[model samples]
Target: MEKNLAQKYNHKDVEEGRYDEWVKKGYFTAGDKSKDPFTIVIPPPNVTGILHIGHAWDNTLQDIISRYKRMQGYDMLYLPGMDHAGIATQARVDARLKSEGISRYDIGREKFLERAWQWKEEYAATIRKQWAKLGNSLDYSRERFTMDEGFNDAVRHVFVTLYNEGLIYRGWRIINWDPEARTALSNIEVYYQDDPGKMYYFDYKVEETNEYFTVATTRPETMFGDVCVVVNPEDERFSHLVGKHAVNPANGEAIPIIADSYVDVEFGTGAMKCTPAHDPNDFAIAERHGLEKPICMNPDGTMNALSGEYEGMDRYECRDKLVERIKEEGNLIKIEDITHNVAHSERTHCVIEPYLSEQWFVKMKPLAEDVLKNQNDPDQRINFYPERFSRVFEQWLENIEDWCISRQLWWG
Candidate 1:
């Protein structure tokens, strides 16, 4: 029977029920044992929020490839999943609690986890609905979540295997710390921004001598923890002062004046304070010179007992007070306004501190070596789109640092 053509296309009439029909017919399922298999695991979206334009675009691309493979007679498996998004989900949950005049601590761990699971289910359902609406040919029968029982078991097995292989270990090292979250963060989690700040110049009086060596720093509050002043070993300007002691202007403590090539002679006043616990470079120097790494700030970014009179004060507040005290003591050389790249927490937008901490890390160099070898093997190489990105991937692997995988969050 011939039917009259509609004046305008109605997308709802044309597309509605079409996806359900395909699903019921098992069109997206991969069950032919004799056929060649082609599979794509969708990059899981965070189960913390609703879908956005980006998710639509990404899923559309995956759908196109999956459909093409299916048409090519391959048993295509378009697997779907959602991520528990540890830090991101926790941050959102924390904000929601804050808006309610309550906190995760007030509700306690178990109750907080219940809330997180509720959030996860709500968003996961929304995500599934969005994916179905997009007409993606996903294998719903094989759907998974990152925190599912099988997935959790797989993750535990992998972690245990790595730990047994000596590729995973816990040790004291300098790491990015989110004070607001009270947790250690990986380097990639830190965002760098250029901020207007100051370069403070102060003097370290030579112990039992009439001379003083001018020192400069951006974080004067950490001076209370400084164990030594470092100068370039090749710099004749401070060569004679090596092995001598200098009185700390902030605490009246005698700290050694040491020399190491790591000190940049052109930077600041050709001298740098060794606050090992507060800085990564200083930590390395301390290890080499056998200096003490005293911590000056608590986990919450407040001055610790090591700061004496400034203890319990916020770090920035202590900085202002300590600078004022230094000026009054006649040790302030100068203060220059400047701009510098400061590390900040990507999630909380708070300033990140390079804190000494004990945390688990995955050794990356060995893994990188194996990956590079595989890339060079023609039979095993994974081709990169545009081809030029292969070099970028290789460069990243070559210079990759140890990855910190453990997060201090209740979820995931």
Candidate 2:
């Protein structure tokens, strides 16, 4: 054996069959009742695709900890698993079907689900092979899938328990909507980017009087939903305009001029259009003032009946057409080009609409409060590394809103 040493090591020769041997010996399995347990559950990789370098890096760290614990005579159970990845998996399957000139809709629910399961199996096998090649010391005997029977039962049990406890409720609320996906997204799922846009200043004439107050908006399309024009109560310039009604420049509809401190005194002629159904801040103002919230856009981002003649048109298309009409009617004051932040869906990459919809929500504030109390307790405190992260976690928890727990997707 000493006479034939290769200059470069052959990893295949050395590593082949080693992991199988380790598994057969039950080295990575943890069934011992005597030794103290040390477990690390893999943050299940998505079944939508093959694992990448990120997965390798993450697994390597877990593998190191698991091996170290095993060496220290602990009953190590490095559990392995894969996620069904609800939306992500469904998107992948849909894309695949589209390539074959057919859609999931054409195939129907049952057939479409069969394809999704096939995709899961294919990707899960690839991931398992990847983990083996990486020499991860995982307990394959205890492997799990998110959609497995036991996991489904566990999820249902928790959901029902939360519902019974009054922690979960269904109600209408403003949410980030993905038009392309036809689903509601959580706030974190919408990312903002600076986009070159136009600010349109238009005249809102006082009803039954020649007096006019100018208002500016970046989204002229949403003007059809405007319930009121808001000005700061303390602003001397627009104090006289308060309590008067203004004609909506888009359709000559009467909208009240209201005073609210939420309006920025220096921005856009100091007047803000309140579209309660389409804007969160406006919705809050509507709640305080008892103004009606009327939705102007359809779920698919088309103008609805509330948009009048602009109905059935895309929101942006309506904007272009309405702007032209406004200018023709002598209501358009000016247009200024500027860059502003626009929210876009993380998955679909389409512009995210602030949509009002009825959906399931989980009360998160109470849960967050409990977590904060536990974190501050000396006996039960969970330690964080790079300790400054504790403040980041605390800050996020302190401002946590109700979590939207439902999606308009067939999967998950």
Candidate 3:
């Protein structure tokens, strides 16, 4: 007599049990190196998150390919892994510590990293359990983590080789800085949002005369760092003011008035205040005119001593107070409501500051050139899906900028 089958398959009863049995027998592991080989490397997931639907879907796709290869009698190696996640994980741990009324600086970098590792270990086990429920045949015995000693060693070797080949170097440049995290971030890590703010028009008085020229800015707080006032070389109204100097409103320091064709005649006031240490375009202008870069804010986004009486105030706080000071001094012409895109940190949600810092960068033009050349070869070695993506990809490579690689966080 045939036994009656259960009315319904119970996931709670069989899922973990079946996965445990498969792992016990090493069915997911590669054996018999002589067999035809098939391998799929799992995209490492950040340790800061748990098993989400997106990860379940991705692993399911990898499982299909792995299972198909196994059915064809090939030795399959589907390796699973997780990343230390660097800034993201560090930020998570920081939030946790803050909830407990402690700080990373309270315990020091070594102890802070110990907490991060503990977090990783606890979360990793939960991730493996969730992954097991999905029934993906990953090689559990060979699972890897990016911060593992073996992986770290491999990374170091690659870095040293690139450095020896002159592909890596350090230089001072404008970077997106997260004031809350107190670290420099890559361009991709910043989120830009359209924000409603005011554009301020202020007058810069000629050092030795009653003459004053109007300039406009979104961030009046950066006026403390202004080293020069720039006008278009052909702007007839201000051509006579070129090569003279103007007195800074925030401080009594005298700054040069330079003429450059890079100025936009139609923009507010037809004159631009050049804050070399605070803005990228201003930095370029300073470079062309050989002016000094005076940093006005600390890494934590507070005004520094260079900002005169406004030192120790928060950046936004200083902006409001500085505007009031300008009004009292009769240098403020007007304020206009404006909507502009402002960058914010993706992790901390604080506004990003255009900071001039020395950071390690990789020159990208050489690498982009190789990719562009290879894609256009007659042999057609690389192909693009949807065909239209080829043009977009080419344009991106053509205009690629130097990549910032260093992060100031304690985690990997």
Using lDDT, give the best candidate's number.
1
Task: Give one digit per residue, the lDDT tens place, for model 1 in 1-412.
Answer: 9999899999999999998999999999888988999999999999879989999999999999999999999999999988898888888888889999998989999999999998988889899889989999999999888888998899999999999999999988889988887788888899899999999999888986759889999999999889998999999999989989999999999988899999999999998889999899999999998888888899989999999999999999999999999999999989999999999988888999889888999999999999999999999987999999999999999999998777677777
Clashes of each: 0, 0, 0
Candidate 3 on 45-147: residue-level lDDT in tens?
A: 8889687999999999999999999999999999999998888888899999999999998999999999999999988988898888899899988899998
Q: Show the lowest summed lDDT stretch of 10 residues, model 1.
A: 403-412
Judge candidate 2 at residue 236 and give its lDDT. 98
**lDDT score for residue 217 of model 1:** 96
lDDT of 3 at 395: 96
For each candidate, the alpha-carbon lDDT, in order, equals 0.91, 0.91, 0.89
Clashing pairs in model 1, backbone N/Cα/C closer than 3 A? none
Model 3 misplaced regions, further than 4 Å = 1-3
- True-structure lDDT of candidate 3: 0.89
TM-score of each predicted structure versus truth = 0.92, 0.92, 0.96
Candidate 2 lDDT tens digits, 292-362: 98999999899999889999999999999999999999999999999999999877788999988899999
* Candidate with the larger lDDT of 2 and 3: 2
> Quick one: RMSD of model 2?
2.3
